[model samples]
Target: MTRTTTVRIAMNGVTGRMGYRQHLLRSILALRDQGGLDLGDGTVLWPEPVLLGRREHALREIAERHGLEHVSTDLDAVLADPDVDIYFDAQVTAAREEAVRKAIAAGKHVYTEKPTATGLDGALALARLAREKGVRHGVVQDKLFLPGLLKLKRLIDGGFFGRILSVRGEFGYWVFEGDWQQAQRPSWNYRAEDGGGIVVDMFPHWEYVLHELFGRVTSVQALTATHVPRRWDEHGKPYTATADDAAYGIFELDGGAVAQINSSWAVRVHRDELVEFQVDGTQGSAVAGLRECRVQHRSATPKPVWNPDLPATERFRDQWQRVPDNGEFDNGFKAQWELFLRHVYAGAPYRWDLLAGARGVQLAELGLKSAAEGRRLAVPEIAL
Candidate 1:
């Protein structure tokens, strides 16, 4: 018979879309349904979640919907429980730091959504506190686990991209303005005071993706814009959108390869996916999105004549070959949760810790500062 280790997790922010769908339903509940996580030594690690939220009704509804046994409106009471081993936070950026601080003080292992705090200093402080308290700490860096990126990583590891030259990424789709149609995103995402902006929101994701796949970002030059200045809220009331809806950035990597990315909530997508990245190298080039990747080798490169007087004859997009998904890919969020759970239970090495999260926050801080100063800025390394 397998020994069972029950790990109680206190989850905050289950009312939000990301928190509800990804963290709660897709990850924790999915693990529970699968009869706990296999710990490789015949010990099954089961997660018992206690949902924590500000809205009692919403929390109760979610708990009852899922057949969960526990729900709490008071974070302090949950944290005070000696049985709770981990505190998972998926709250908005503005409220994250305080809750995480309390969790750390309570000696709970902490895992949180990115931009761990609204600013670099707060994020770094969290890292320091977590370290001082001798607790396992992590922040979600889920993009690295995506199927498309996994294929890209496989290609790079196989020497498909010999001496990689550069990477270009496009991420975004038009978020409906609330006046004519309800906005897909929350109103707080357009309010700077509420810790919302494309730069702060996305640069952290870019930072880790680039750092892990290409190289560490040495510097950044960025321009931001508030393309939709007025938007209605969930209540359908008009309010000024002070935050930037778009950001165009050029990041210089440590290996001399430059990465240019355009992030926008206002732009319409004309590509295969909502987000896509094209990597160019000496031997070959590849384009990858959330679930697929296509590659073109130097030997198969197309040559087209420039003729202003005639219609284009070349079918450029058809030339690249699709990279096959060689293995089953699990949901990115659930995969990360499983890894983090193993790390918490069996002391497995988890690299995407709070310090890595702080690096992401550092990039966002510099990106925004670069936009405001109208100049390129250096990305200094952070240490705790």
Candidate 2:
């Protein structure tokens, strides 16, 4: 018989799309189905999740789907349980702080999805409280574990981007107006009052990605606009969209790399991927999307002359080589869950803590400020 360690996890806000889908079903439950993760020391660690949410109907359905008997609408009752070792919050951005604080005060280890809170101060406070309580805590930074970005990291580590210069990212596609067909995203995503906008949603992601792969962000300049004034909701009712639908931003990294990323819900896709980053270095350049990455080296460089008089005929697309699948990748969210669980059980060094999450929130806040001010703003280091 194989030895296994079972950790009880209380998952709050598991009824939302990201909550139900990523953290609950695809990650923890899937891990359970796999007989949990092997610790490589003859002990397998398993996660036992207690799903908690406000909607009893949805919670019951989700629990039944996962063969779980523990489902709760009474948060205080659930939090009082001594058996629940960890508390995970996949709640909406606005509600994250309060639930996490309660979990921390209840003596449970904390883990949560990012923009851990809507603002930087709240995020920082969570980190401080967790440290003071001497409890393990983590925040979702799933992009760092992505296979595409992982491959890019491997290249950077291997000296592929010698003296990296700059990074350019293009992300987004047109979301439907919800008149003829349903909008692909939730209606709340277009409302500023509800914590919805391109800047808040994406800058956090950019912060971690750039900081982890390249270096810390030093400064930011951004422009934001509410391109779509009205959008229909789930009830087929039109509502005024007050948030910025699009954001164009530039960031300066500590390693001297300049990163410019554009995010929008009102644009059409003409690029290679819905989200792609092209990193240019002295020796070469590479483009990485959600699942695919391609590269070009200095040795294969071709000189082209710009002439308006002549018909442009250069095979620009054929010069890059595709990166192959070196190894199978676990789902990004699933991978992070395994790591967080390992950290909880074995005291493994997991670096994506609440502090890292706060940095992401900081970037988003600064980006918005930069857009409003129409000037560059330095992202100063945050101290406890």
Candidate 3:
């Protein structure tokens, strides 16, 4: 018989889309359905979740729907519980630092969504406190675990991309201005005062994606714009969109490789996926999306003669070979949650801590500065 141990986790911000769908439904509940996670020695570590939120009614609805017993609107009360072993935060950027600080003070292992704090200093401070308190700490770096990126990482490890040259990424799709149609994203995402802006939102994603897959980002050049000037809020009221809806960035990597990525909420999509990255190297090049990857080798490269008057003969899309998934891939968020749980329970090595999160925040801060100054900016390393 397997020994069972319960780990009480206080989850905040379940009212939000990401927190509800990804963290609660897809990750925690799914883990619960799997009879908890194996500790590799015949011990099954179970999760006991305490849902925390501002709206009691919403929290109660979710709790009742999931058949959960614990639900609370009071954060202080939840943190005061000695039985609660971990605190998981998926709150908005503005409210995250204080809650996380309280959790750390309560001696709970802390895990949170990205941009761990609004700025680099706040992120670094959280890392410092976590270290001082000797608590397990982690920040969600979910993209690293995506199937497309996993395949890309495999290729890099197998020396497929010999002397990688550059990477080009295209991300984003049109988000309706809420006047005509309801905006897909939250209204807070468009208000600069509420920690909105594409630079702050996406540079964190690009930071880890670039640093982990290719090389550390040394410098960044960016231009940001607020294409959709006005939008409707959740209440169907019109408000000026103060945050940038689009950002164009060029990042310089440590090994002289250059990366350019365009992120926008105001553009239309005409690609295989909403987000796609094409990585070029001396040996070959590969394009990867959320779940699929395709590669074009040097030997398979086709030459095209420049003839403006003539129609192109080559079928460009048919040239690249699809990369197969050799193994089953789990949900990225669930995978990271498992890793964080292991890091807390069994002392597994987890590198995507608050410090790594701080680096991401650093990039976002610099990216915004670069766009504002209309000049390139250096990304200094963060130390906790």
Cα lDDT of model 3 by residue, 160-185, tens digit: 98899999999999999887788899
Q: What is the TM-score of each candidate against the true structure?
A: 0.99, 0.97, 0.99
Stretches off by above 4 angstroms in model 1 are none
Candidate 3: C-alpha RMSD to true structure equals 0.8
Tell me the lDDT of candidate 2.
0.89
What are the per-model numbers of colliding residue pairs?
Answer: 0, 0, 0
Among all windows of ten consecutive residues in candidate 2, which has the lowest summed lDDT? 90-99
lDDT of all the models against the reference? 0.95, 0.89, 0.93
Clashing pairs in 3: none
Report the lDDT tens digits of candidate 1 across residue range 196-237: 999989999999999999999999999999998988999989
Name every residue pair that clashes in candidate 1: none
- TM-score for predicted model 3 compared with the true structure: 0.99
